[model samples]
Target: MADNNNTLRTGDVVMYKNQYRATVSEVNADAGTVKITFDTGGASTVPVSDVKKA
Candidate 1:
C-alpha cells in the first residue's frame, strides 16, 4: 500500500511492483497514480500502491 508520507514527485527514484527501479516522470495524486520511466528504457503508469522510494 502507498504510504501517506511517501508522497511522490517528479524526478524521484522509486521501485515499481518490486520488480524494477524506475524514475518518476509524473504523479497524479488525485488519481493515486504515477508515471515512471525504467532504467531499461520503458515507461508506465502505475498505482501508488505499487511504488516506493528506492
Candidate 2:
C-alpha cells in the first residue's frame, strides 16, 4: 500500500472503528495518529491508516 500521510485532516469527517462516523479533532503528523470526536459524544486517538473519509 502507498503512504497515506496527509490524507486525513482536522475538521474532516471520517469513519472509524466499528463504522462509527466522527469528526477529526486533530492530526498528529509526527505520531501518525488522529484525534476523533464521535457523533455520539466520544473520542479516541487512532492510527491514521485506521480511518477513512466518511
Candidate 3:
C-alpha cells in the first residue's frame, strides 16, 4: 500500500465524500485521523486514509 504521510495537514483545502469542500482543522498522526470542517459549517474526524488533498 502507498504511504499517507505526505498527503495532508492543517489549513490545507480538501474535498470530502466527493461532494463538499473542506478545510483541514487538525491532524492527529498518532490517532490516524484528520479533523475537517466543511464550507457549510459541519465538521468531522475522519480516518486519514479517507481524505484526499484537493
Candidate 4:
C-alpha cells in the first residue's frame, strides 16, 4: 500500500468523493490524515484513503 505521507502535502489541490475539490491545509503523517480546506470555506480532516491528487 502507498504511504499517506508520501502521497500528500500542504498546499496540494485534491479531489474527494462527491466530486469535491479541496486544497490541503495540513498533513498529519503520524495519524495518516490530512486537513483539507474546501472552496466553500469549510474544512475537514480525512484519512488519506479518502482523497486523491486533483
Candidate 5:
C-alpha cells in the first residue's frame, strides 16, 4: 500500500478484475499486497496497484 494510513479492513468490498467483489482479509503495506477473499469463494493476494476501493 502506497499509503498506510488508508487501511482497509475485513469485509470491506473492493473491485478486482471482471468487476468481481472481494473482501479484504489481510493487508501487507510493506509489500503493497492485500489478501482478498472473493465473493466467488476464491482467495488471492493482489498488489495494491491492481485494486481499488469499491
Candidate 6:
C-alpha cells in the first residue's frame, strides 16, 4: 500500500525503518507483512511499511 516494498521479494535485502539491514525471507502480501532475517541472525515479521529495498 504505497510502500517501496511493492517490488520486494525473497532474497532481497532491505533497510528496516532506515536502519537495520535485513533480508526478506518471506512475504505475506495478504497480511501486508514480511518475514525478515536480520544480519544479526534474529528474525521477525514486520509490516511492509517498515522496510524498503536497500
Candidate 3's residue-wise lDDT over 1-54, tens digit each?
345556687999888877778999998888888999998998999987677778
CA-RMSD of model 1:
2.4
lDDT of each: 0.91, 0.86, 0.84, 0.86, 0.79, 0.91
* Per-residue lDDT over 7-38 for candidate 6, one digit per residue giving the tens place of the 0 to 100 score: 78999999999999999999988898999999
Off by over 4 Å in 1: 1-4
The residue ranges of model 6 lying beyond 4 angstroms of the native Cα positions read 1-5
lDDT of 4 at 32: 81
- lDDT ranking from best to worst? 1, 6, 2, 4, 3, 5
Checking candidate 4 for backbone clashes, the offending pairs are none
* Candidate 4 clash figure, as a count: 0
lDDT of 3 at 53: 79
Clashes of 5: 1
Model 2 scores a C-alpha lDDT of 0.86
Clash number for each model: 0, 0, 0, 0, 1, 0
State residue 4's C-alpha deviation in candidate 5, in Å: 7.8
**Can you give the lDDT of residue 14 in candidate 5?**
89
Could you give me the TM-score of model 4 versus the true structure? 0.82
Q: Per-residue lDDT tens digits of candidate 1, residues 8-47?
A: 9899999998889999999998898999999999899999
Instruction: Write model 5 residue lDDT over 9-43, tens digit each, in one string.
Output: 66678887748889889888788788999989989
- TM-scores for all candidates? 0.87, 0.82, 0.79, 0.82, 0.77, 0.87
The C-alpha stretches of model 5 lying farther than 4 A from their native spots are 1-6
Estimate, for each residue in 1-54, the C-alpha lDDT of model 4 and write its tens digit: 465454787999998774889999998878988999998789999998788888
Instruction: Give the Cα error of residue 45 in candidate 6, in Å.
Output: 0.1
